[model samples]
Target: MIRTALWALGWALLLGGLLAATALLVLRQVTVLHTWHEYLIAAASFIPMLWVPLLLAALGLVLRLRGRWRLLAATLTLAVTAVTAWPMLPAPERSDSPQLAAEGSLTVLSSNVEYGGADVDVLTRLAGPEVDAIAIQEMTPDFEAFLAEAGLFERFPHRVGTAREDAGGSMLLSRTPLELIDRTEGTAFDNLLATTTLDGTLWHLAVVHTAPPQVGAEAWTADAAAVGAMVAPYTHGNLLLVGDFNAIAQHHTMRQLTADGSLRSLAAYGRGRGEGLWEPTWPVGHRIPPFARIDHALAGREVSGPRPVYETVPGTDHRALMVTVSPSA
Candidate 1:
């Protein structure tokens, strides 16, 4: 009876290992999930992709009694974790390309920089002369004073729009002399467009802070459509739309801007080891970027710029996106 029990337990361990492997690996590629189901699956996949490897190793310890099988189970578990959790992990080092810099690509940093409890000293330290233009959100009166003390008011001679204390107030700072063309108020949310001439070529920079996704799906839908309409006409020129878009890159709302054949900056330069593409820029000033890529710096084909720089900026929950553009480039 004792021997029979031992045999049964051994078989059970092997079976569990086989079952976990099959579920985690074989069934992952199935295409039966619908659109909504796919979204749910994507959301669900985000966590387990990190948990499964560790779980597998733990399970392997419980199930494997001997040499070869135990090693196999542990290796498989580690492999799974590496594939899923690697991209989500924090990349502390500077990941920008020197090649792109040598070619004179503009790197634009877009950061929310949370309104309350912001540190201007930290922001200034992070934002070196490498930054060409800054598009900021959540700039309170106090934060404005902070920037002024830091001498951003003088450094960036070209500017546009007032720093409104209200919800629609967004601010833009540029080194190039900029002319504020229009600040479109209340179609859905506030957006501003300014033009600067570089080497006789006119370039339009649209600074936007759209309604948050939590404001309601209908509001976001309308706001996104309006933003699309505003930028659609400028697709032929050197136009760049930058700011806290407050939506994911994959979301339907952001897709509207690229609908006019404009180039998405992140999608263009984001390559290699998943680090380039996983631009999670929220919950700023943290060790690891937040799980959503809400902020963006989008460029059209006519805009001659360098690769987009998504870096942690001073005093905000978002990173500062900086890009340098030249007329001849």
Candidate 2:
């Protein structure tokens, strides 16, 4: 009986590990990761917490060798089912934001405009005084024309747009004066960083849009790590990094950004994990949304801020992320 029980335990862990690895691999694909793939990975993360049921089933199997083998299979099946269902379960509600706003030195908005989206009104509506700077991705030619026609270029004196061919572009629009820096092509993605002076402090603002999900797991991880390593040197100063990370806040890829303890997620302070209105942002027209959090705004260690908020936009599939940041002395 003891030997049988030991065998059951080993099998359970092995099966659980395999499922978890498979989920991780699926999540590396941007499209797959955005849709049902993310839900699977979220469910797998709770396997350790789910060991209780597997253990109970193993006990039942120990009673009879043949019966136990069947029981073990049943147990593994149940474990897989439970993990997939975990993300669907509701978590604790997020705390409400304080009604009164704090006096922060800086405020910024980060968004992926879904390549100009369906209309320009959505972009105009999102711009306001509270947002001192705007970081955006997926800028198409139409969107650039809309910005010029709408006169937003005048408001944000300093801006960078990489819409050379209209597919991939990184932009930074600032109310405060900024100095143009070279735009460099990254191995796994495209990036543009510029030096800006805001409230008498000099800062580096890096805008990055990593490789799409089709790149697969190894490429996704490598690209993410490379992006983190590239920005690793700028931990100091008032740094604000923003864009579509294409990964969740809890994923290992995100952890690579914290070298020198400089990078932190704005959602960490926001209420309810800020998963955004419904999960999954790709394929904007899907009827039932795939739940996920793939967009984010991160800051350097010295930077402090109030909680971040996810704002809904009309045209794009993604929700823009906004935050109030305190300036460095």
Candidate 3:
């Protein structure tokens, strides 16, 4: 009886885990859930794609199921795994000769500095002179001074936004002249808007950090949607938006905002090709590996950019995101 009970418990665990993963994947691919709870689930949509297959395979061996039963379990696992991974499959490289630095191109590095505690030397080293812009979220005054002292702010003299000692602060620094566009009012972190000439072409840039969904689903959605609407005008032209969104692309708000096709993310760089394609950007420098991508370098329709390059910085909770944007031919 004890052996039978153990077998039953194993089966239950296997079934439960797979079902939960499936639900999360579905929410990512297509979700109608709107509440904060649902939004939280959607944000975690990628975990299923990552672990379901491996976990199930391990469970199969442990369960010691016989012939047909084992075959059935394997088939079920494969089918579900494929479905979960479909949305993240590669979108194909846009350029064969992707340049690291180019004329008339704007390369930007964005980071959520975790209340100004990110490693100053490391961030400055990674963001060498080739980087055209740097967008910072959670820019406490101390962090601003740190970057300034490091000569980072000097590299891109043109700037917008302000530095506060709280999460609400944001800033954008550029190598060329920048014109200020009003920051979105009434946001946890105001979306900083500005424009600059890149190789003689005007390109709009937005440095954003949306409110975390945990604050409440309604607030998160409103913040996300408002930022999207505020930037709608520039979506069809030379535009760029970057920073920690606190919400992944799968969230209903993000999906709605990006549905117009102007905002494109290079998160699919290595999908299905044996490379680490689903790069996650949050919870870095934590007990668990960073597993969710909540930060981005979103490019506009008339603009193009390479897959975001991520690097871990000491003391920050997010991997810094970098990408270069140019006029698409």
lDDT of 3 at 173: 85
TM-scores for all candidates: the values are 0.68, 0.67, 0.85
Per-residue lDDT tens digits of candidate 2, residues 234-313? Answer: 76777777778876655556755653467887655233453322233343546756355677778887777655566667
State which candidate, 1 or 2, has the greater lDDT.
2
lDDT of each: 0.61, 0.63, 0.76
- Ranking by TM-score, best first? 3, 1, 2
Give the C-alpha miss distance for residue 242 in model 2, angstroms.
1.2
TM-score of 2: 0.67
Error of 1 at 224 (Å): 2.0
Taking the tens digit of each residue's C-alpha lDDT, what string does model 1 give over 88-162?
A: 565446545543343333434455667624567766655566665667666667778878989977877776765
Pick by TM-score: which candidate is best?
Answer: 3
Candidate 3 has a TM-score of 0.85
Candidate 3 stretches greater than 4 Å from native: 1-6, 36-65, 75-100, 269-276
Tens digit per residue, CA lDDT, model 3, 1-329 = 88687688667767776676566666666655754474455446464354564456446545657678867766766675575565455433444454665567888889889999999999898787678888989889999889889998778888888888788889888888888875777777868889998777788989989888677777777788778888888887788889888766666766777786767665644423543366678789789877778897777888866577788899999989888878886
- Give the C-alpha lDDT of model 2: 0.63
